[model samples]
Target: MASDTNELFPIPAYCKTIVGSEDGTIEDSPLQKLEISNPARILQLCEGLTDRTTKKLEIKINKYLQAETDASSVFMINLLTVSEEAMVQVVGDNILETSIRTPLSEDTISDIVEYKDNSLKCAEKLDPKLQTLINEIVTKDTGDLNIVPIVAKERRANIPKKTIVSPVYLVCFVNSSKDNRYITTLVHETFKYCLALLLNTRECEEERRLKQQCQSLLAVARKLFSHLGDLNDLLKEIMSEARRLTNAERCSLFLLDPDHMHLVAKVFDGMSPAEKNTEVRIAKDQGIAGHVAATGTILNIKNAYKHPLFYKGIDEATGFKTRNILCFPIRDEDTIVGVAQLCNKMDGHFDYFDEQVANAFSIYCGISIMHSLVYKRIQDAQARSQLSNELMMYHMQVSDQDVADVVTCPNSHDLPNFESFSFVPRRVFHRETPCFVLEMFERLDLIDHFRIKRDTLARFILYARKGYRDVPYHNWQHAFSVAHFAFLCLRNFQLVEKGYLSKLEALAYLISCLCHDIDHRGTTNAFQQQSNSVLASLYSSEGSVMERHHLSQTICTLNTEGCNFLESLSREDYIKCLDLIKNMILATDLAIHYKLHSRQLAMAQEGFTRSNPEHRYYLCSLLMTCADLSDQTKDWPETKKVAQLIYTEFFMQGDLERKMGKQPVDMMNREKASIPDHQLEFLTECCICIFRILSTIFPSAKTLVDSITRNIIAWESSKNVFDKLRVEGCTSYDVLISEELERQVQATLECMQDP
Candidate 1:
């Protein structure tokens, strides 16, 4: 009866039998399967065990085995329910004579207890160590086998009501046997699957974490690339991001100070704010960061204390203990601009990944740093330029005492009528030229009407006088004379009353006259351009070299603290005044004079009015030109004196030109000059035309034209006598007939003068 029962329920082919030895050893027997007399019925039963069901069962078995405390024992338990009753069985070499059975109505615990009792009985025949481990597992509660509870629930859901069902868990035991290697292999293989599943889950989580870290790195890179600020702020942000990215406890960003060939710590995140600013500099070949900067290489050191190139001075100074270091160079193009040094990592020592991230971040750091450095340099240069301008203004400022002297000087009430042909400014004002200017301002009521500050006006006049170079013709005296001529035009022509010029225009005209030739170098525009002087280079493109320089110098003088007389004007009025002054002064350029004169003549033909800006500009230019050459319209003695002074200036320029290997023009060359002939040409071509245009504008200015015409006649007579003397073999006019010519010219001038 026993042989018949064993053949009917043979062990499955997948099951292996463990044979026990007498010396407490267990060995694996050959696999065998029970013969099914009805092969078709066995195949039908196997079809019910699908791959999904088998996988779930395997997972449950592995979970239970892993939960067991004993490493030597593996358990495989299968629970089957048939006809409202459940059967529990352990799949192994040993099998109970009767399967543990319980009613479906009763709890599954009864079936599990019955199975444990049967498993203990079978374990007694195995090796002592294996038997002991099984006994412990069966007797003890071993806590609830909660592993794969979801799989248990899933299997329970699949069971049909009132039908046979089986839930299987396989367990294996490895005993202390010399020939139990196969059993040990089975045990290890089962646990290896569980470990692999656990490892796979952990790897997914690690992958997610790495992706997040990469995103963070990308964000940091974007911010660093777009960073636009000063160097200090940028460096601090870079170091902070580097520390956070690499999980470093401390970070230092050092810039290569190319000037000193040293590494300077621009930012030290580990240091306190007070200590951060402390100067930290290292030679380019000295330390780790310096080495990186010098060599442009990345250094990942596991232990900074162990590295020979590690710099410990900063650590000592800051009370920071650095365990590891990751240093890399920051590069702009091919040049290394700085280095980033990361100290001990928070979690572990710096690794290759950290080094790679630092290397990538340094690229953006270098660009940001380079941009910040360039920006800082630009700001510094602008500050220096502003400071230089301020210093220039400071030096050019007029003193308070000089201003006080001019303001306090007695006003000359007995000033000559500047509009008269015989008006001599040098004879009238004498040494009190500035005083006469003040009286003119007072006579025009400009000091009150324009809200001019007395001290500022006085300072302006004194500074204007001082601004003139000690040239032969275009000096302080000449400036004063031109100003007097402008004043004469203002007073005599009724320009302001007749609405030909506004009060502001009149004031600008006078101021322009005073400052037009403030810093004359006794050289013409052509001479300045030919010599390529500083003034010419500055204003040559604008077409009025000396005139523009004079205007610039005038602006500089007015900018002086005590000499800014026009400061009282409203913003609009001030701008208009400056514009008028610019136009009036620039018109003094002879190159511009003909254009202005033509424009004025056209405007005069079209009925010019002060309300028209173009007409006003044309008139202002004409007035400035007329005043500039007013000496030509003076009496013969004054005209003759001016001509001599002008010739002296021309001769000096000619000498300079000859020394520079340049040919002097006819008027400028002393050796080639005929004074009388040059004077005749100047009066006809320049002076007479200027007076003729002015006479057309202001009919009262005809007297100026008449005076200039009479001077031209006097020059013509002198030229005739000079020609006669030259033909008569008189080699020199000074030695022969000079007295006679002087007497003749003096009689002609005395008759022409207003008596």
Candidate 2:
């Protein structure tokens, strides 16, 4: 029997089994007795019983006992007789009991049972009594059977109470044998161990399911946010996603209109297109959504109609019933941008878990709406830019007659000494500058080399002239003067011979010069940024607002009808020419001159070569800058005339700035401007440095440097005369530049001349 116990039962090495005496007195089994008395001690002993141990016990019992048995014999009777007569009598009896006690505590079991019963009644569409008594016979704490009454109360009652009873047993067996009691304890311990294993398995499964749900929600949100569409479509998708996430029948998205202190319903699901498009605005202080948006608080109302803050007007207007609502604030950073409202959850009512999911979804909603708004704004800006370009083309259109007039004009090869420092463009062109520009193109034979039409060149030139605004300094006249200087440089500097510029490069440079100052507002880049003008917003990051605007206008003009002069060039030449044109025009911005001039000067010292594209472009930019500021390199009379015109444009901007409640800079304010002093500073800092750098690369330009030096001397002499007049109480610029002083300045300039 001892060998059979070791082989069949296989009790663990750590466990000791006690055999009761026939007389029912086992004095040496203290631990066994304690386990019988304390159910918790039984749990500790049963902790080590794995599935292998339980199976072994089951096999051993099945070998000794009958396979079929009554509940009383299996659960209550504790002793099994191994005699042949007892075995033959109970052979085919089922030994394993079908009934088992749950592992939950008595109070927890009572709560669950009551909830189950109420749920079943609700499912059956039956209203159970408010208080119902369920009588049950259960084992007491002392292991004694007792009759207890359990009462089930209303589920939603504020103070609903339940009376709990321990688990009930259906059958019982009376046995005075101590061996039977010990066997009963062993069977109960095994049952407790199995129950604990089942509970742990269930808990693990539930945790895994919850994790999967969270991951699924996040994946859905990622897919929704990845959608790039207009704002209205994005809003509709967001509302649809919100409804899906919360299992809500309907959803609406309300945007906070801070400007008007209103919460506007921007998107509402479960509505026709016409109804959704209807604008519905509610005060920020009213309605559940309004409250959430204003306070940035989440509201999960189980019964929205019962809440005082719930506004019923929306439901009435939409012809829909509102039962429950989950309203969450949509926040961008710390600011509440909007609100998302979900109504009538499919599952009885919204719970805390629904609130959590809605809150998470709202975060994605806020980000998506922000991106959509930005996308819409970009589309609107693009539309406006296209419209502006169309308007520009419309007003600046060059008629065929205008083109024919300029193209048919008699071409003259003896135009003027356009490269001379004393040459005056206003007198040389004789107010027919467009015709002279066409003659220059004809002289260069550009029309035949590029296969360009005479009408196209004429139209482009005329359109470019018209592109310049009526500003005093940066107007059509200034544009023509710059283009003229570029032409003179290309013609006389032997640029092609020195490998500095090709004919194509000269054409791009001249065109870039003509279009460099188009549509000038007479205000500086600093003024544009300070005022936050539209041009500033568009081009401030590139650091040359007006220059970029000029480039844009140039492209728009070239795209106009009959103005695309480069259309006949090969694809490669067209692309290269356009790139050179863009670079040259942008280079005219004085803000970048110091860097470009320094780079070119260093390259020139290293023996500049046009083979390197970078070095060639640097020289091109340098030439464009010099042409832009060519007024400072002219004779004294031409220099003074250009200076007065520039100062007039500056003073006009200064007066406008004052009207706009901004203080003008010292150079712009007419009251503070000293003409001779300003001219001296510009000559020393800007004009002289430019020409000096150019002379290093092209020694032929040294004459232009000498011309700028002589002009500087004239400005110095004029400053001295002005200082003397100021000391003599002449306050006005007109009084300071008296006839005597002018004649003196002229005499000094004549003496300093190259002749």
lDDT of 1 by residue, 109-192 (tens): 223332321223333333343334344445444332211101112223465554422222224443323223333333333433
* Best-fitting candidate, scored by TM-score: 2
Runs of candidate 2 with Cα error greater than 4 angstroms are 1-396, 411-413, 419-421, 725-741, 751-755
RMSD of 2: 21.5
Q: How does candidate 1 score on lDDT?
A: 0.68
Model 2, residue 275: what's the lDDT? 82
Q: Give each model a TM-score.
A: 0.48, 0.55
Best by lDDT: 1
